[model samples]
Target: MADIDLDNMTLDELKKLQKSVNKAVDGYQDKQRKEALAAADAAAREKGFTLSELTGGQVKKTKAVSPPKYRHPENPEQTWTGRGRQPDWMKDALENGQSKEEFLIV
Candidate 1:
């Protein structure tokens, strides 16, 4: 590979280079994942069991979405399921002496 003088590159040239690098990285990662999956599948077949049978068929478990329990006072579109960390709006409201019940969806 030829040495590239990144310090001397114009903004457009740098941006183009960055785009190319990102594309190349994505392609490399995809190829690696495919190769790994193929190897796992082959190994499973050799063992007389499919990969999905040993791994519960899911690459990742999906969490069931909880229904929103709280809504923003000013914006009905903004809501929280009353799980995880409190959102900034909820925090600010609580700091200003607003109770959690005030934001209840019901």
Candidate 2:
């Protein structure tokens, strides 16, 4: 690595250098992770097992989305899935004696 005279560099020059350094570091880290994973996969295959199987083949879990069960009377775009706490609009309407059944999407 070459010596950098950081104090002499202008702000723009420092920013450009910083960006270049960040890109280089990220690329190096990604390459290292890929190489490590490849080595682990090869080792697992040699032991007559796949990497996924040894790792339990687990995948990232995503929250299940409930379909919208209620919609605003005037604004068709505004909707609620009827799972969590009611929206302010719903609360206000209910306070004004509007029934929840009136807001049902069906």
Highest lDDT against the true fold, candidate: 1
Clashing residue pairs in candidate 1 are none
Query: Tens-digit lDDT track for model 2 on 1-106?
Result: 8999999999999999999999999999989988988898899999999888888986233588899999999999889988899988899999999999999987
- Tens digits of lDDT, candidate 1, 1-106: 9999999999999999999999999999989988998898899999999888989986553579999999998999999999999999999999999999999988
Off by over 4 Å in 1: 59-106
Worst 10 residues of 2 by lDDT: 57-66
Compared with the true structure, all predictions reach lDDT values of 0.93, 0.91
**How many clashes show up in model 2?**
0
Per-candidate TM vs. native? 0.54, 0.54
